[model samples]
Each structure stands twice: as C-alpha cells, then as structure tokens.
Target: MFSNLAIDVALGLIFIYLLYSLLASIVQELIARLFNARARVLTKGLRRMLEDDDHSGDLGFFGRFTFFNFFYELGWSVVYFFQPFKNSPFLKQFYQSPAIRYLGENSAAARPAYISPAIFSQTMVHLLRGPHKDNQLSDADAIRECLAQNSLQLSADTLAHIRDLFEDARHDITAFRLLLEAWFNETMTRASGWYRKHTQAWLLILGMGIAAAFNVDSIAIARILMKDKSVREQMVQLAMSRQPQYAAITDTLIRKNVLHRDSAFFRTDTTWKVMVRDTSLIGVYGMLRNDLGDAKNVLGISRACVTDTTATGLPVVRCGFTHPYQRNGWLIAAGWAMTALAISLGAPFWFDLLGKVVKFRSAPPPNTTVTGE
Candidate 1:
C-alpha cells in the first residue's frame, strides 16, 4: 500500500507538470503570434540566402516578388488555423474566391509552413530559370546570371561550393538541382537547431512564470501526499479516471491542428472540418469536465496538495503559499525551482511517466502468506 501510494504521488506530480507545460506552450505560441516571431525568423533566414555583402542593393523586382509571395502564402497557410490568426478578416477575404480557395486547398499538401531545403532549392531554381527561357542557357550560367540580376550575395564558401557542384554536374540542370537541394537541407537542419534552442529558452522562461502563478511547489506537494492518505487516494482516483482520455484528446489535436504535414486544419473535407472545430484548450477542458466532472475539482486537488498555510487547526496539512522571508524560505524556493524545471521537460515526458506509474499501481499485490505444508 505504501509503495502504491508513493507511485500515486509521483504520478500526480507528473500530471501537474504536464498541465503546466501545456499551458506554457500555449502561452509561448501566443507570444510568438503577437510578435510574429515565426515570420521574423523566416525572413532573417531568407535574407541570408538572398543578400550578399558585396551586392548590397535591394533584390530585383522578380526576386522580391517571388520571395515575398512565398513568405505571404506560406505564412497564411501555416497560421490560418492557429488560434491567433484563425479569424483574420484579411485571410478570409484573400480566400473568398472559389478558384483561389480550391487552388490553396490542392496545394496545401505540397507546401508545409516550415520551409525545407528541398522547397527552397525548388523555388530558387524555378525563379532562376524564369518563364519560357528553358533551353536558352547552361544551368551554371543561368544560376550565375540569376544571382547577378537579383543582386543577391552568397558567401565565398557557398559560391565556391556552387561552382564545384556546377563543374561536377557538368551543367546538367537536374544534377545541379539535386546538389542544391542537398546543400539546402544541411543549411535548414542548422536553422532548425537554432529555432529549437530559442524555443526551449522561451519555454523555460514561461515555465517559471506559470510555476509562480500557480504556486506549484513540488516539495510541499510531496510531503502532503505522503502524509495525507485521503488526499493521495482521491488524487490517484482522479488520475486514473483522466488517464485514458489523455491520448485520444492529444492525438486528435495533433491530427486536426498541430502537425504541419497533416494539413487538415483548414481542409474543406467535412470530416476534417468537424474534427478540428473544437481544437482549442477550452475544448479539451470541456471534454475533461464532461468525463471527470468540474475541472476545478481536479485543480483544487493539486492546489490543496501544494499550497502552504499557517493554520494550526484540527486535521492539519501543510499546503498553501509561502513567502520568501519565511523561516523555510529556501526550501520553498527549491520546490518552486524544481516544479519549474519539471515543466520545462514538456508534457509528453510526464504523460509517459504517468502511464508507467498507473501500470505499476494496477499490478497485483505480492502474496505474503506462507503455504501450509
């Protein structure tokens, strides 16, 4: 029973962390939207490819048009279903024409919001080749002429790499395109790493904020759960009830709105449209409320477990807010820090740990009675 109780406490703590992490993610997304962080990062990356130190002029008309169009179209497609942009009148107006809407729907499968190296290479090649000028020039000359005309700058190393590829491909357009795609893939990989690093930094900052707001002190919660049998039992039951629904809800969210490759968020397909209609935090909370009763009941359990109080009344339990100047201030700070760090581990990590703990709780107890001879 003690072992089972300990597992329950661990699971409860993990569940709280997971919720905090999800809230942090939602907040981070909101911040990104408010600041247009994605567009800014994308523009910075594109500029590196389109501008050179030596050729410090604005891109040619065609170059500007192609790049800006790509940015606008990709931005609309990616963010159209996100909460921050879903109801934009401008996007609605842009897609009002049936023909344009149909084209957008059809092309969505081929164009993810995140610009890949392959996509970049393909777009660049198409722009460089231009309209109705197919067999007019060698691939190498066409690439060089396109860059020169656009006043685009490339680093010395990148220029040398392209020249080497041109020689190796013997100016074969297809071969050159493939080489460029490979090079672009490498570049995008590095860019992705940078993006992820910044995202983690944002998540950590948000996690700390959420921890403070919720007063999620891990040490206090652990002590309360270990000592209070009733609270522990109630929490374990709540977790058990909530665990089965977690995967279904999360999977639906990913399939309908989160995954870039899925592209189901804005599809005209009736089934997909129905599935994505309620892909919001409120929707998920509603589902939980329907299954587990009031969402506040669950939150109350977590709050009661972590909150520090000074009451010395009967049925006493240590939980409630603690001030930094209090006698145990350092301990409270450590607990808050631990909670914040757990949230930074992200929701999936806690979900997995909760699953394992639940399985452990469900296992049959060991037999202690000896068999009669």
Candidate 2:
C-alpha cells in the first residue's frame, strides 16, 4: 500500500548505515595494524639489548613463527631451545606452554607458547645459571632421563593428549613451571588418595588459568574465563559437531575412550577438572602407571638428579618409564612435515575438504536479486 517510494527511502537509509559501518571497520583495522607494527619494532630492539646483536635475520622469523612451524625448523628450534633433549619433543611443549591461548588465536602470548619446551627450559636454565638468577646445576642429562623414563611408560594415545596439552598452553607456558612445581610439591606431601590430590590440584590450576584467560589486561589470560559455561560448551560443541574426515585420527584421543589417557584423569566427578584440562592431562599421568592389571590398563619428567637419597626422600618418583613405541626426531619430523606439506601444497584441496567437513546450515533464500529497492 505504501508503494515503491517508501521502499526507496528504506534502501537509502540502509546504504548510509552500511557506509558508516564499513568506515568504522576500516579505521579499527588500521589502528590495530599500527599497534602490531610498533610492537614488532620494539620487540626487535629489546632482544638486541639483551642478547648478542641477534646477528641472524632468520632468528626473527624463528622468533615469530616458531609455533605452527614446519617439522625441520621446529626440530632445530627445539634443539636450540634446550641443550638436554633438544632432539626430543618435550622441549616443543615446554617452551610453547607459558603464553599459549587455545581459546584465542590473536593473543600475544600465543606465539611464545608455540615455542618448544626445550627452549623455555633452557632459557630458564640460562637466566638462573647466568650469575643473575637461580644457580641450578646443569646436569640436564639426568633430568632428561628422569622425564624420559617417566614419559616412555605411557601409552601412545596418552602421549598424544599430552602433546595437545602443550598446544593448549600456547597462551601461557610460564604458568606451567609454577604448576609443574606445584604438581611435584603437592603430589609428594598430600596424604589423600592420589586421585583426591589430583582433583584438588587440577581444579585449583584450571580455575586460576581460566580466570587469567578472561582478564583482558592479563597477557596470558584472555576472555574465555568470563564466558558462560554454556558459551564455551556451545563453542566446543560447534567445532566438534561435525563429522570430518580427520575424525578417525582423533577418535582414539577423544575423552571417553577407555584407552584414552584423559579418560582416567576425567573419570573423576569434579566439574572444574573436567573442563580445564578438557581431554589432555595424559601428558604425565599415563607415564606414571606401573600396573597393567587383569581388569584394565592405565600412566616427572625432570632433568635434575637426586643421588643424595638421605638428603632428599626421593630424587625420582617410582613411575615406570621404559616401554612405548618410540618415534624419535627423524620420524617425528617426517610425520609433521607430511601434514604441513599436505596443507601447504594442497591448501585449496584441504579448504574444500574442510568445507565438506563443516556443512554449515544455510540461511533462508533471498526474496529477489534487486531486493527491497
């Protein structure tokens, strides 16, 4: 009844709104880019101040893209990160944990968390030993053995979960050290059943981690903490709601699988622990298990020595650490390299595959090509 004149006026108003929104978005992007540029410039300057003139331009790239790095470079970075088992995968997780943001990609700490654990541990060692920080002994070979023996006893699937745990920590690897220490101290003295101690510790750490994640000003913590559980649940459900082709590889690692290491850590009743580690606590648990019973099967890793049995009650916990299918440096590198190469070389095909995996619901069909105009 109002005719096309009314429609014309409405279209004009819509166009004006669109223009304003576009301009605002563009300005916001420009300001963000400017800030990023400034931060990178300052980062370069600061490193030069502390380290050797950073003679290698490649170091900056390594510094920047170490996480999500291809297999070979990642291995080297892991080596340079820690002198002990730089050749091993532990370094990758250690360095990459302090500031990782599994919940948010854009966080600053995410990059550091991407670094290998070897680098972070070594860096800590250097700072501590450099006549300025703690005077920790450099007997990393012993420490590596302790952790290695411990890690090897774990099941392959359990090791996979721990690997994911490292990525999840990409926003806050530093907290790992505190938590790891807490794990040792708390694990040793607590008289409660191991499960109860574990429940309490995981809850405490998860609560703090989630809290930090949501505090906007906190570098390690992002906003995921404040989000309603419903929101987080929905987000996770949304991601996993799909039946992707890659689901086969992940099926063994899913939380509820009996063989999955996380299944044991989670089978507990606490809500906080269930959510925090989600499905990735097997990092150490699977390794600690010494018994494979008739009923069911289930798990330090450190570089320090404790030969003074009288002085220290136990330099090493009795967790068995001898058996597992070991995939050392070369094999590990080749596998990751294959994955990267697949995605990089077949990016378009992968994108198409991804599209198939996520079959998004469609909107209602448009009324007309010209619309209300």
Candidate 3:
C-alpha cells in the first residue's frame, strides 16, 4: 500500500514540474526573441573570432557588478542595432556586405540569427581580395597583400594566423576559403555551447521565479497527493490528458482533438461547431485567460487562495498576506529550490520521465504462486 501510494505521489509531482518547465521554456523563448539573443551571441562570437579583440568578451569594471549584467546584454542588442553604420571595422564591413546584408531584414536593428560558414568564408575572401584586375594580383596574392598592410584592422596574431592558413592552402584562393570555413565552423561550435549555457541559466532563474510566484511547493503537493486519493487520481488524469501532446505518429486531426481549441470550441459541444467568434482585438485577451486557467489547473496552486461568491452574486477573492506561503517560508523556499532544479532538467526530461512513471504506476503487480517446489 505504501509503495503504491508513493508511485501515485511521484506521478502527481512529476506532472506539475513538467507543466512549469514547459512554461519556463516558453517564457525563455519569448525573451530570446525580444532581445534577439541568438544574433547578439553570434555577433559577439564573430567579433572575437575575426577581430581578435578580447575586450569584447567582458563589459569592463561594470561587468563585475551582478546588477548591471542585464544592462550589458541589452547593450549587445544596441550594438547589433548600430552595427551597420560602424563600418570603420572589418567586422562591420563584413556584416554590411551585399551577401551578408541581405541575410537580415533591411531595418538597421534586424540581425540574422544564423550565417552559414561557407558564406562567411566567401565574404571574407571577396572583401580582402578587393577589386584588383585579373592581370594585376591574383585573388590569393591580393588577400595576402591586404593582410600584410593590415588594412582590414586585423590584430597582429589574427593576421599571422590567416597568413599561416593561406600558406597551408598553398596560396590557392579556393583552398584558402575552405580552410577559413572549417575554422569558422569550429569556432561556431563553441559559440553554440555558450548560447546553450546562457539559455540554461535563464531557465533556472525563470523556473524559480515561476515556482515561487505560483506557490508550487513540490513537498507540500507530494504530501497532499499521498494523503488524498482523489487529488492523486485527478493529477494522474491530468497527466494522461497531456500525454497525447508527445504522440509521434498521431494524425493532425487527432492531435487537435487531444488539445483544447478555445476559439473554435467556445460554448460549443461539438468540435465542428463554433458559438462565439473572437476578433483580432480580443484574441490576446482570450489567450491570456486560457493560459491563466491552464496554470491554475496544472500547477494545483489555485487551492491556496479561495474565491467565494457573495450573497449579492459577486465573487470575493483573497490573496497575498493571507496565502499559505507567508506561513511556511522555509518550506516554500526549499520547495522552490527543488522545483527549480527539476525545471532546469528541461521539459523533455520530465516528459519522458512522466511517461515511464505512469506506465510503472499502471502496471499490474507480479503474481506470487507457491507450488510444490
């Protein structure tokens, strides 16, 4: 009985964490989009790679301050915005070049989230070669001449490095571009790692914030689930309802049926019927309402605060100071830490774990037979 109850409690807790981790990821994606985070990170990586400037890696004395960290990221976006006009540097020229410029929108602030290494190599070769006639210097020789003059503002080490790559390519222009592409690809792999680390850090912070805000105390929720059979069953049912989202070969219509479509099904019993139509103006409001309803149901945190209907047919809701979180500060903190750690494991981890746990919980107990042995 204890073992069975333990499985049920675990199922409930895992379901809640899965929901909030997904929520954290969605918020993180929104923030990334708003800040153009990928482009900013790519730009920083490129600046480091080509310009050979270590100064860009840190924000100086201000960078040492934790409070100013966000301002520094915001500053990167600002720099990305003004990058086109700052053509004094070779990095700026590379960004503004015809081939590179078209990758992003015409707007000054628009930055491409990705640039192929092939394009990078080709653009660098063309920019460095300049407009020398075929009879004059060969493309490779022109590039070598530019490096010797240091006209591209390349650091001495960077210049030396390119010269070595040029020599390694036997002074062949095409071969040199191939070598450059390989170099860029290697550097980009490291850049991708940095971006992933940044994302995980953001996820941790968002997870803790969401856990605290919703009073999603995993310990408290687990205790409730273990003690209350009805609550445990309800949580399991919710988990089952959500499982269809992970279906790999499910048909589009079947997938649609598995998830609620509030706009299409508003006040309708049939899937094909629509009772109320929402316009563009009210769509955002509807989405927010739906999201809030989902949050209340999935997190099981809505029970902390009660809403009672008054005698005059009005609703009264009490929150904040009256909430249980105020009373169990230490427990709430511990729960938040646990929740944040779980959420940091990412939604895919929880989703896969939830599936396995649900299967285990539902599996029939092994039969024990004592025969004449």
Alpha-carbon lDDT, every model = 0.55, 0.29, 0.66
- What is the alpha-carbon lDDT of model 1 when measured against the actual structure? 0.55
lDDT of 3 by residue, 63-90 (tens): 7776677777667557655662342276
Clashing pairs in 1: 52-153, 307-319, 307-320, 308-319, 308-320, 308-321
Best by TM-score: 3
1 versus 3: better TM-score goes to: 3
Candidate 1 lDDT score at position 314: 42
TM-score each candidate: 0.63, 0.17, 0.72
In Å, residue 303's CA in model 1 sits off its true spot by 9.9
In model 3, state the lDDT of residue 50. Answer: 71
Alpha carbon lDDT of residue 30, candidate 3? Answer: 59
How does residue 74 of candidate 1 score in lDDT? 57
Q: 1-373 in candidate 1: lDDT tens per residue? A: 3256668788777766756665665566556544555434443344344433122123446445666665654565455325322433322332332322333223432112245454455555655555436558765577767555543334454455656776677777778788876765565555555555555678788877766666667787677677777767776777777787776755554564431222311223322242234247567655543543332244342433343345664453566543332237677678778877886665566777888888877866677555698
lDDT of 2 by residue, 1-373 (tens): 1213322222222222222222222233233333432222222222222223222345566655545344545464345433422333433343334332241134652322122233323443332223332455343333333234543333344344433433354424455444333333332222123323333333333333322221111111112212234333333233333324224323422332211222232122212222213223242223212111100110001122234344557554443212221114443334333322232221123333334323321223345344575
RMSD of each: 10.8, 28.0, 9.9
Off by over 4 Å in 1: 1-3, 44-112, 116-118, 130-135, 138-140, 144-151, 253-279, 285-327, 366-373
Best by lDDT: 3
